[model samples]
Target: MKVIVEGLHSRGHQVSVVRSSDSWYIKETSPFYTSITLDIESGFGENFITTFVAQLLETQREGKSAWTRFKLEMEQAQKASELHENTCKMLEMLFENKEVIQSLHKAKYDLVLTDPAIPGGVILGHYLRLPLVFNVRWTSQGEGHLSIAPSPLSYVPMTGTELSDKMSFLQRLLNVIIFGFTEYQISQYVLPNYVCLIEKYLGPDTDYLSLFQAADLWLMRVDFVFEFPRPTMPNVVYMGGFQCKPAKPLPQHLEEFVQSSGEHGVIIMSLGTLIGELPHDLADEIAAAFAKLPQKVIWRYKGDRPATLGNNTLLVDWMPQSDLLGHPKIKLFVAHGGTNGVQEAIYHGVPILGLPLIFDQRDNLFRIEVRGAGKIIDIFTMNEDTFFQGIQEVLNEPSYKKNMQRLSRLHRDQPMKPLDTALFWIEFVMRHKGAAHLRTESYRLPWYSYHSVDVMLLLVGVVLIILGTFAALIRCLCSIVHADGTFRRKG
Candidate 1:
């Protein structure tokens, strides 16, 4: 969103962003843009979501089987419903505050752009009757954001399975089960809650389902190189490296730190914006591991400064991540495997030592591992030995760096850059008045029709009818022959 807004504003377009006041990142915006902050204690909602994410991550770390994870997810769904209700209450507070609502919707904006995860924007888009566009920063499989292109259940893995296009028979069956369960949870638990909230807060006639389906464009933040081959819709645009750019020069102290490593390069460590603090024991373990490394460590520690920090390790609350990755002296990235972070590392051709913590991070690490550009170690399973070994493996193995460089080349070898592609699609939708023609007819088709199941059933019915008729004819002919033989015998 920051990149898109900056681009648009640079092109002389007015952009306004409505966001929660308690956003995790520092609030940064251009003077040409407008920012609207919701006045609410944002901690509860974010904490609730984080709790759910934690549950998932813990389950994965436990090495639980699929059935166990599924059962836990079902339980989690119930908790999610409660969280949804609480989130609705928070939104209700905003809706009740007429001053904020008026400020948000007063100007007739040309388009209402939103992330699909955020329902407030979806509701507002419907209420204002504006052209809605989704800038989805994740996979386009679930959350009622069904792809127009038919995703084959047999091959395309479920959201978190980390499987490739090729699947065993059992794997495909599990995929079906997982996909069905996800849809069931969304329809039975999530969507209905959102509908009720919208009706209660927004108005009676506002249909969020329709608004979701009415989206003019879906600018998903993934690329074909990273994703398995799947059918895609015209309305969907891939903008994987939109957040990535040419790196700027690092500050002198940071530069000296990298150069001071001599032959050994520096490693940049971060857990992304969500997990601000690590458990003290884990932090100490990390500190101990970094202490043994020859490479200089630039660690982003959000919690109380670790007492075990060695002379080679530098701790800070934040660092310019992209710029640091682009440095020649940087050899490895120890990160949470968030999409943007992984993409930036790929853009800069830096090998990763991934400790994926939650959500899409696990899947992103799976991709990095499959591509041979990195290694994945469970956060819970990390000890001084394993963590240090993982770092050494990536840094020592030339294959990791070679694969990352190859990927970076492929990522940069596009017809148009990701930002330009995004801008072009955005303007294309604007010029063509929503680009309705780009949408696929699959959206209008029933599930059976979309997958050709109905047609197959019709074919089966016709074959059955022909077989039944042939059997009846043969039976009648045999009976006639017997009757004629009996009549000849009587004569």
Candidate 2:
């Protein structure tokens, strides 16, 4: 959004942002236009992470049985949903403030540009009766309007599942089940609470799903190469690598470190924002694994130093991830497999050793593995041997590097840059007054009709009617034949 806002501003369009105070990352960016920070106290941080990690640890401790793991996951999902509902409630309360409502009403914006995770924008757009453009920053992670992008449940894995694009028969069935669970999650756990909050102010007639489905455009953060090919509406525009920029010069320290590594090269390791620190034992194991490698390691460690730091390792609170990846000296990336980080690695043609911690990380890693560009190391059962071997395999193997480079070229071989594409659509919506023509009629249709389920039923009905008629005719013929035979015998 920061990139889009700045780009729009540069093109002489006025932009204003309504931000939640809880978003500490907002402070890092300086947008060209007005930023109205809602100072409401939404005390909700990502409180579920601690609980989620605890659950994961417990699941591991209990021998990691399939049933136990499934039960743990269910519990975790329930807790996370409850947390999100409370957060939504807080946002609802904030939006109900007289000052906030009056200010929003008076602002009279042309379009509401919003992140999909934030429900506030959907409500505001509905209340204002303006068009909406949902910016999905991650690759199909959130609850999306299925009308806009109908996900193929048989192939496309659900949000939390570790399944990949290609699936076995059983896996596909499980995928279907996961799809149903996802819908259940939305309808039963997520959307009702949001509907209550929206209807509280907007009245009973305003449907939450309808308002969300009414989004004029969706700027998804994905590329066809990285993501599996699935059915999508015309309104969905894939603007992958929108956040990628040309490599900049590295810092002096980083430059020196890269130069010092010589031909052995360096590896960049980062687990993303949510998982700030690794467990001490795990950290020690990782350090020990790195100690055997010839490549210098630049690890973004937020916690205390590991028990043993390899001489070839550089531990820092943060590193210029893109800049480092762009360097010729950087051989591979050890990442949590977040879409953005994975995209960045792909942009730079760097292979990866993925240690997926949670959420979409597992799925992202699966995609990379299927592409033959990376390997996944389970965080739960990651021994020093597996970690070291993963590093060695990716580093020594040429196929990983070759595949990554090939993918990188394919990703960059777009007709227009992702940002430009996104901007065009953003303006396209404005130029054509919401671009309603781009949306499929399926958007307004029920699921039964949208996917031609009704048509299937109609075809089935016709076939059934014909079959029934044929069966009756055959029975009548048989009865006549029997009657004729009986008459002959009596005569």
Candidate 3:
């Protein structure tokens, strides 16, 4: 199949890509340059200014040799952390390279797939008028914010909503002075000033919203085991855990260590790439928790350890996460609840204790918690006491493990793997010229699209008012005319 995939390309099926790549050599480390040119964190098409700024904030403490690589990332993060500002700004490159992209789109492809992360995939998918699969790794990519948007304005970045449900009296009064009239106008007026750098540089594309609705199908990178709301749509399938590669072999010593741990098992601690830092005291408490447990701990700390150490605990800067999770001897997983880590935990059937820091971490862990497959430790309020106690509870109880195992079975019981499921749907669309008939009946409902509670109430109010007005007119006429003689109208 002439399939085209647009994503990190680090994993998943092979496909064409138009993303940013800059090589920075280690020896030449500076704000201007570096040794390795790794792909940008968000997606491909992010232009120079935004990429430079984002990289500035996302990096850890700068190395003396690195020469302000750390400083740049931090500075950029401060400037453009808001989603609307960040996304619209990052898409500048799309506007700049419009002609070239248009030419690329005209080229033939059997199938086109993209992530909502970079609306480019959606862009290319639509331009070609080809079969498109929305690879939604994040939950907010859905139509609504799913009940967690910080403010109504917050939805502007993700959903393009125009109003707030809970506009406070003070906020309304302040907005009158600040924004004049119409909340939508106010947000639109201010959005450009804050995040219009992207639009300024990238130019424009009018069809930005169509890419979302015109999807042929969607390949969700979420397992049913973890996502509790359960995709109510038929076309949206759960095959998130499927991947092309097999597990790499574990080191002999590592294998022996896991096997020797017995029923107590090994506890794996890892916070995925973005939020790897463990607060000083939390790390100590975690290490201490390991001391209390019979199970040996294999923690991927990724930073300098505290002065103390326990005999049974092992800490390293890196770990073979997938391989370790696949190990039969591992009993518990401590994760930051990133989508990838969540999928990995479920695939291996290991119970997870998620400590979410920011962004989708809270949403990701919330899903797992709601599904009854895992436990969560709030990063903001979590202390050594709660952390230690949570771990002990997960370890001591059998329910969490049993539930995880049950989910794993259901996940694996599918006749077709997730990757295969995605492949079939993609091909089906290609063969049928976007087999859109498969989209569910309910999604097409007027209620689904309109979301008109207030509108419905208004319609009822109009009918009642019209009826009441007619009744009043009839009564007035009857009072005015007395015994067929003309009379004054009733006041």
Candidate 4:
């Protein structure tokens, strides 16, 4: 059962990645901008491109052509850097690899899994005829047209603008078509005659939907207790709490520090990977918020500390969070609502106060609140009072603590760990020879497979036909005779 996992470079994978830099001919076939980025300069912190995309969102608010601006912004985003280009170009190279390409033509796969960003995974599933599983690690409602909910709709902020409630059907269709072209351009790793190339290669078929029916599973990084991904299909599995292990023992000093805090315990705060720099004002506000509490604050602030420091507040750039959550006396966990961080909180039965930033953090916090496991604080309005209120509410409310434990049990009670569940599903496909039969029900249904729009239309049409027949009969009867049974058939 040869399974290929794209965009994952963990030791757990089967294929040792061939570095693009080492292969001369492969590098020559590679996208020019992509090769430059892979040459070792742009790959380090290329996430600046996403921030750049975030920044361009402001200009998108200028005028009636906001949609135009939004479209241009997407173009600007891909053009902004080569990390994205290299990602697409690499897929293109793999597509060209005669060996890989031929194997795909005559699919020798049991299962194929990929991160959401790997579009080639879409192409591969088509070639290999394997079950596709999307293991989502972030907030990916997918690209513009494919987005369902909680996806940032437009790069531009929709509120306080002339934006319509939803992009009209025509607009959505256009976006789908546009996204298809964009994907092809991305595959080529440069701007070319996208429309002409798409027309020549793809014809007038205007659907951005990939051949995803080949995939049978979608392993969402969500837990039933914390995040509820829309229960749209049984094929999608939420295994967030599955692979987690109990936290290892904390260092002696840290354990002593937390336990020494007594009934006051300690507050844990970490902002995650990207935004390590704690703004001075937020730091001051946080410090002030904790000043009123009896708890000692362990803030994961990754920067030069302010000159003013309280005796109870500890500013450490690095803290092992798993160990922190398992600490004997940690009262509350204040985090940025990343999946791993939130999972740790629920994993250790610790109550939470989430200050989510962009991406799925909002959706993640919404799930947290919905689950009654935690409270969310908007990062923008996070002052001493708001922060204090949120933390205090969570700490005071015994239900939050109780709920955390309840979820911890449910998460742990599953038949196997999530990793095991994931592994089982992948292997299950191999044992069944690609499990293509499982997708038969979906294929049996028409294009309205998920929604049943066809059913709705059929019902409406039936009603209309019945009404029309009744009306015609009444008209003919009235025309023939009003009060008498006998009359000339037609005068």
Model 2: per-residue Cα lDDT at residue 87: 59
- lDDT (10s digit) by residue, model 2, range 171-210: 9988788777766756665676666677677897766666
Q: lDDT winner among the candidates? A: 2
Candidate 3 lDDT over 337-442, as tens digits, reads 8777887777778888987654456666766666677898865456667887898887778888888888777777778877767766766776787757755433
Q: List the global CA lDDT of all models.
A: 0.79, 0.80, 0.58, 0.59
- Residue-level lDDT of model 4, residues 49-135, one tens digit each, is 446534443333233375754565465545533554444455555645677557455634455666554344544454455566666
Model 3: residues >4 Å from true position, as ranges? 1-14, 23-106, 127-130, 139-207, 244-249, 380-385, 438-491
Tell me the lDDT of candidate 4. Answer: 0.59
Better of 1 and 3 by lDDT: 1
lDDT of 1: 0.79
Residue pairs with backbone overlap in model 1: none
**Candidate 2 lDDT score relative to the true structure:** 0.80
Q: Clashes in model 2: which pairs? A: none
Which ranking of candidates, highest TM-score first?
2, 1, 4, 3
TM-score of each: 0.88, 0.89, 0.67, 0.68
- List the candidate 4 regions with Cα displacement exceeding 4 Å: 1-86, 97-110, 117-120, 125-130, 137-140, 143-207, 228-230, 291-293, 440-491
